[model samples]
Target chain A: MVPTSYYIILSAALFAIGVLGVLIRRNALVVFMSVELMLNAANLVLVAFARERLSIDGQVLVFFVITVAAAEVAVGLALLVAIFRTKHTTDVDEVSTLRG
Target chain B: MESLQIPPVDLRLLTPLLIVVGWASALLLIDVFFVPNGRKKITGYLAMAGLAVAGLAGIPLWNVSGSTFSGMLVLDRYSLALTWIFLIAGALSIAVALDYLPRHEIEQGEYYPLIMFAVGGMILMAQSADLITLFLGIELLSITLYILTGFAYPRVASEEAGIKYLVLGAFAAGFFVYGIALIFGATGTTSLAGIADYLSRQPFAPQDETLFLVGASLVLIGFGFKIALVPFHMWTPDVYEGSPTPVAAFMSVGTKGAALAALLRVTLAMEAARDFWLPLLAVLAAATMIIGNLGALGQSNLKRMLAYSSIGHAGYILLGIMVAAERGAEAFLFYMLAYTLTNLGAFGVLIALEQRGEAAWSIDDFAGLYQRRPMLAVAMALFMFSLAGVPPTAGFMGKFFVFTAAYAGGLGWLVLIGVITSAIAAYYYLRVVVKMFMQEPVRDVRPELTRGLNTEILIAGVATLILGLLPTPIVLLVEQSLVALGG
Candidate 1:
């Protein structure tokens, strides 16, 4: 059986990469994908932990996360389309109309 | 397979949530099929009716206390009291939205339903006995808010705020899920009671507790963003300024109220590791107060200023979490009521003056407000004073209790910072008052006054002063409602 530490480390790396993409990406599509990646990273961690503990709760949590991620994508894309219609650009930097 | 014993389902405990959800769903359908475009105000009234029923439903359950659904939900005065606050906030929001939406010509039936769902989610947050339930509650509220924030479509700023909130909200959820994963890894359960049981029995991990602490911190980060603590508060000003006035007003109180409930739950579940979190919350609270106040100093936009003010109020509420052991939870409950009343009143005034197709939130717009609408101007002055923690208003009472509670919990330094930041906050709050009363009206920002808007402002003002001058009833209610965290 694979060691649990390896799974945890890999999940952490994936999560970090996902966050980096969100922080650095300009395009809204890429950012949305990055968020999905982060959710998947967390799902990986949950499944790995479930196996290590022989607990069903972690796997159940993975299912919930996946479901929520789908709903989030639905909303995010709808919003992106709305913004795109007005701004004609998907770049977050270009969407800046609100100023302090 | 042996027959799985079904958990004892108590329908009575769920009355408040059921009322809200059922009303919201039915109202949405009615709006789509039955209600005409010109008569959209009917939906707003219906929303208020639902919220009122929901609030009253809680009265029957005032003394009810237990966990059900395999302990996924709990019913107690703590949750019930917060539920009442959410209901009031929701109804008040609908009242403010009644005329504003139609005036702006962006009247939609969806708005009322969304607010109801959001309030329902907040109720769920307060009652949640498991992390998964809490997460669902947060998402439920967030998703509704995302739609409502952008309800003013074709307006670029509204779309921008909605998109930004959606993206950042999702990002935060990712962190929250990862945190839940880590906590489950360490403790092997997501139930608050189970976690508490695990922590109580497990010997200290010392150097090996990296996973536990990291998970806890990640969860804290998720909440920080929700509560708009300083580092995570960048989205607040933009979102509040761009979102429709009523929606922004709702989120400022509703979201913060719900998030604080969950935060209090999480804090209690991890009481065994107070050594790790106690100081962390202190630093976070202090920083949130300082930054939130200082940020509000230069804001010329009224909505933006209130956004910063809401952030600062969140910081003050954080003090409640920091000192949860010593009357802190009671203080938290009291402060939520006070803040909800005062802040909603402040925003209601803004909603009153806002014109269609133009942002009329500038301080200059408030000039000569005293001359044109003397009563309304005085109400705004009262709200500003309350927000600045001046005496004879609900905000003052809230700060008094919270700071005393924090002081008792050994947060003297944080309390001092709260004091200093609050003093700094007074300048900005007073500036609004000075502009409204002292200066001449630069723009007749006043829209045709609606009876609904007037009722909301008057209720807010009277409630603020009442909560301040005679806080005994609410205070006692809050004190009795502290049945939380297995205590």
Candidate 2:
């Protein structure tokens, strides 16, 4: 079995990848996927911590987080689809109508 | 190990939230069953009635004080006062929504329910004393807002705003949850009071210091995004301009107020680490003031202008938070009240004028509003002045107290920045006023505001003036509530 530190390291790596995607990706869909990656990374850390600490509250919290994240993704993807249909592009650069 | 039971529910303590949720559900049912023919007025009335009843119910909870549900939520004057603010803002938004939604042909039955649920979430947030409850409350509020932001689903701009807000909002929430996990790991608990006690007992150690500071910083980032402080505020203008006007107004006030209140609670309860968080908040306060004001200089759209202006206003409120003194919270509370009333009033007028179409939302569209409808022109003038922080209006008093609190807190330089921004803001704010009163009537105008809308505008106008002039009583009430929070 792997050490708890291994899980922590994995979570950190995933979180960094998520941040990089958010910063580097111009496509709105990819950026959104990166955000979901970050949330899942957080959940991994939470579950790892729950195991290390021997508590169910942390696990319970992960459940709630998943629920909210699903709702968020649903709404977000719907908006993205609508935007793509109108602007004919999912690139963030093309969606700058309100810029000064 | 004993399983943790669901915390005991307190019916009396939760009456305000229940009222809002109940009314929201009722409105949804009414819209679903009776309003299939697109009768939007009934939904508005039902939403207003729910908020009014909730506002009335909140009155009795004003002086009460205690922790409920095993210390997860607190019932005190601080939360109650904010409950009333959220309810009144909700009601006013609903009223304005009645006029705005139908004109745009985007009336949806789900709008009122989502708004009430959002208000309920905000109330829960204000009352939360534990990290878990706080997270839950924020999610509830944010998810509802996500839907409301894109309710005009087919509108490209609306959908874009909704997506942008969702991505950024979820990013922030991720930071918040990770922060909570770190705090729990470091302190072995998720309760705010528990963390405070744990931190107090621990001797100073380098590793412990890093853990606490990193944890706190993450949490601060989470809230900074919500309040739209400079670095995290990139989403503000797009979301504000793209969403329906009433939703934008509700979010600009309700979300900020709840987030600020929760930030205060956590910071004050964990006062042991003031050295770490306070300076960071101070820098944010200054930067947000400069960035928001400078950004607003050339915006021709009314919604985008208010969005940036509200960002600057958030900085002023943050100055009050920097003080972290007794009077600081009171000043913060008073400023929030003043800002809410003034902003809703401005949006109320915008929603009223929007009856013709989105074309009326431009600053140039207001040319010779004085000639079109004298009363609305006067009301808009007062709102603009108040927003600009001019004296003899609520906005002025709100700024006075916030700056005074910051000065008392030794944030005098930040206050100086605030004053400078206020001056810069006056230029843009007065441009609208000039367009209204000075320019020629470019197009033939018709007063399209209904009786309900006119009444809302009048109430907002009177409330702004009254709060500005006779602020002492309200100030005292907020102070009493802040003191109660401390106890």
Candidate 3:
């Protein structure tokens, strides 16, 4: 049987990678994908804790989180498509019309 | 296990929300059936009328306090006061939007309904006591705002602003949900009161500290994005500058008000976690003040300047939260009211000056505004002074109370920094006033001010002045409401 600490550490590492990708990547699509990765990492930890504690609430919450995440992704992807159509680029740096 | 009985829905407790939603659906239906071609000016009036009725309905429920919907929502003075604010903001935004939308040629009949839906979500958010309800309320507000931000579809900047807000807002929502899950897992409950009870009793184990901190930090980050606090305010200037002026104005007040209400409730109720969140909040508040004010100094566009100015104002209001006093809550309420009136008045003038089918958004556009329209020039001056914290104005009084609360709470350094930033903010604000009064009018520089009703302008101008001159009654009302919160 795997130790709970191992799962926790793995999830933490995954979350860190997601954070790094978000901060370092200039492509908006990649940034968004990184955000999804971070969220999934969180969900993994949540499921792990739920299984470890034998509680239903944590799992129930994960369901809601997944639902909201899916909705968010839909809106976000629609926005990306819209932006790409206009500016013709997905690079975050090029979308700087309002920058000070 | 015995079956749990669900309580009947209390219409009185949910009157404000129901009224807003009912009006929203009614407006949608009106758009669908009666006004297919979208020549629906009356829909704006109807929306305003509905919000006014809801505002009136909220008056009687000010003193009523209770939880409903299986403890998911709480109807109390805090939410009631904010409901009135949101309703008034909705009415004002619709009034402004009515004239501004037609001129821009983006006259969708659904615009008014969307505003109502957003305000409805805000009302729900203000009253939410459970995490599920809070998330739902935020989504309702955010999704509508996302569409509204980019209503001028096909415009590149508008599309960019909309996409930025949608993506970042969704990311923040993820953080909010994950935070809720972790918090619920640790406490065995999702109700704020339940979490507070559990945290108060449990000893702080080092192994669990990381989870607790991460959970609370995620929730704070969610609100930080919404309120546009430092490190999380990257989307604000672009969104505010790109969106229609009225939508930006509505968002400046509506989103901040709801987010602050939630922040106050969660932090105050979660008594065991003060040591964790307070210092982080203080640092953010300080950084937000410095960065926001400094960012405003170089901006030439009037709307972008005000956007940064609003960010700075958020920092000032966050000072109230940092203090965490009963007086702090009172100060926060007073500051929000003052901010709502003053910002609406400022945007009212901006909307009045905006030329048809052109973005008259720059500072130079306002040169010699006094010569062009003396009443508007005076209105803008009043708004600028109020925003800069000039004495005898509501803004000054609000800032004074916030600073006083901070000082009383032993955050004197923060208060001092606040004073310095207010001074820095005064410079940019006065520069606009100077351009209005002193600069020569450029050739062929005409702005459209005829579309707005004389009555609306007069109302905005007088409200700004009166609120400035005598803010005692409103201050006392805020005090009373905070007391009712049992803070």
Model 2 scores a TM of 0.95
Interface RMSD of each: 1.7, 2.2, 2.5
Candidate 2 lDDT over residue span B305-409, tens digit each: 899999999999988776757478888899999999999989888877765444466787788999988889999999999999998999999999999988888
- Specify the highest-DockQ model's number: 1
Q: Taking the tens digit of each residue's C-alpha lDDT, what string does model 1 give over A1-100?
A: 9998899999999999999999999888899899899999999999999999999889999999989889889988898888777776445554558875
* Model 1 agreement with the true structure over B30-86: per-residue lDDT tens digits: 999999988989989988999998898889798888888889999988999999999
In candidate 2, which residue ranges exceed 4 Å CA deviation?
A1-3, A84-100, B1-7, B355-357, B443-447
lDDT of 3 by residue, B73-119 (tens): 99988888888878878888888888788888878888999999999
Model 3: pairs clashing at backbone N, Cα or C within 3 Å: B394-B468
Say which prediction, candidate 1 or candidate 2, comes out ahead on TM-score. Answer: 1
**What is model 1's DockQ versus the real complex?**
0.69
Ordered by DockQ, highest first, the candidates read 1, 2, 3
Which candidate ranks first by lDDT, i.e. highest?
Answer: 1
Ranking by TM-score: 1, 2, 3
**Candidate 2 chain B — worst ten consecutive residues by lDDT sum?**
B352-361
Better of 2 and 3 by DockQ: 2
> lDDT (0-100) at residue B297 of candidate 1?
97
